[model samples]
Target: MNFTRINGLAFAFSAIKYIRYNQDFTKTTATKTTDPRPWLGLDGLVLALVCLLFLILATGDGSGNESDARLVLTTRRRRVQRRLRILSSVPSALIVFLLGLILCFIRDPTIFSDIKLGPSRFHVLKITWDDFKVGFVRGAVPQIPLSVLNSVIAVCKLSGDLFPGTELSATKVSVSVGVMNLVGCWFGAMPVCHGAGGLAGQYRFGGRSGLSVVFLGLGKLVLGLLFGNSFVRILSSFPVGILGVLLLFAGIELAMASRDMNSKEESFVMLVCAAVSLTGSSAALGFGCGIVLYLVLKLREMDFSGFPFFRSKSEPTAEDESLINP
Candidate 1:
């Protein structure tokens, strides 16, 4: 099929994937429809709708072009935009989360009665050498390339786009990721990376500087120290449908990164890459396909008409050029 047709199909596939992921919260088991898990029930639908409504109300017009903060022509408008940015930066997602907790309590007054407060078990030296070896060989090896692509290269590109004069070097990002993961492994913390999607989400929500990340890190540390595993109880009772709505918005914000693909070829490749990554559940495979297609399209632009074999008799060939010159 032509690339254009392929691109359209790719977009459709991506859209379907996104919809299904969010819709799953509202759907029950296909194997046993008789099971009552709040799927498609009044509670699930109501929770989702209420959360959606609150999220929409909380995010009216957003922080107003945070990327263009320095380009504002008038002082009055700049002041207004700055105020909006500060207000919008209040973490509306957290507000929605708390609202969900309140709704959960209203529905089931004894939801948190079973939660026992205590210090969570520390995860120091939890992994053995053999387990590390196996996991590193099987999982880490395959994920390295994807991490480089998304965590370093894509992040650098997106940061440049979001903060025009900012310079977030790939080298620094790679080192930071490596160091963080190395230290985290000792404490059995989940491996972490600076993903482009996360950066985009931060930018979408009025996070303009490193200070925002610092604040976030501090907040997380404080929460971990204070609540520990006990907080999991509150998180567990939170409505899945509301979480789906939150993720749906995050996905949409991340998808906006593709808006920079202005050319038809780039857009086609991006869509195909995304579709493959989503449908196949392998970013590496999608990266390989995108690279191959990009090279092929680029090669197609070469002028074979200049070759002697491709020229008609009316056009001077390489041999005929010598004859004419003489």
Candidate 2:
């Protein structure tokens, strides 16, 4: 349940910012992203187990001082400070979000109840909180944003899962989640996505607590209990443009980290793999892309050898391992 807790907290944090601070009509269109779905990975408990092993291996300490951990701590602390400095620019959004939380705590719920037609002839239906909770649904499949290489891997992974009690594929999961959501929203529940928006909102809001996320759940629950399907309709019907913008920002930022890290050949291979995935969904095409990319790289025919993991292997190593060891 740690995944649920962690992901929940993330969703909650973002919901606060999204519901309270983001007022612009085009709020959804301002960012882009691709948050992994909740169901894709091992359960939180499993992750904790893995983390425990990793931590045990990672820390060379039966005695903390006996290890080289001091240097690692210093490095971590410096990184945190550097990140804090970068975040100082978004004070207004933070302030507004906090204030909104306060107001929501004491204020009587604002309930909208009506239906009408706009001047543009678009149908307008006013709903309440009761309606919004029904909208919780799965996020979209990542096929649109991910490269062919990733897609092939995903498809293979999914194929493997299809045989038995395996984790569901995101593509198929998204459809099922979407179908259920469409039904729930159609009936009168609050809207929820697969978690991209929630993750984006969480990252935006600095929510790292269960309390933070439960508030979002509570808010939707309150709204759902009051207004029912109307609120879900309103949120679900929110302009795709807004979602597009937010997602776009998120995607660019997500990919940015891996952008530079690569084997020039690997990078080129990855790019072609991604590009092919971009153009076609054929089983043969995806396989051909991956295989061709690998073969070409091995032969040194198609070239674009990048640095390791996209980082320039050429960058001067700050720490000379030989010096330390000697």
TM-score per prediction, in order, is 0.72, 0.34
* Best model number under TM-score: 1
- Any runs in candidate 2 off by more than 4 Å, and if so which? 1-201, 209-212, 236-242, 257-260, 279-288, 295-326
Where does candidate 1 clash, by residue pair?
Answer: none
List RMSD in Å for every model shown: 6.6, 18.1
lDDT of 1 by residue, 1-326 (tens): 12222322333444333323333434565321223334354246555666667666556544353556457458888787677666665677777767777766666667568555555678678788899899899879988987887788877876776677785898999999999999988877788999776676666666778998998899877777777776666665566566666655555555554436668888788777767766745677877788898899988997787888977668578998899897
lDDT of 2 by residue, 1-326 (tens): 11122222333334323322323553476342223223212222233233324323322221122324445657777776555445433432334333333333233233233322232222435556654444223223333333222332333332232223543465664565557656665444444444433433343334435576788788766765665555544454342222332333333222321322345665565555455544534323544676766876577653445545556566445477556675
What TM-score does candidate 1 reach? Answer: 0.72
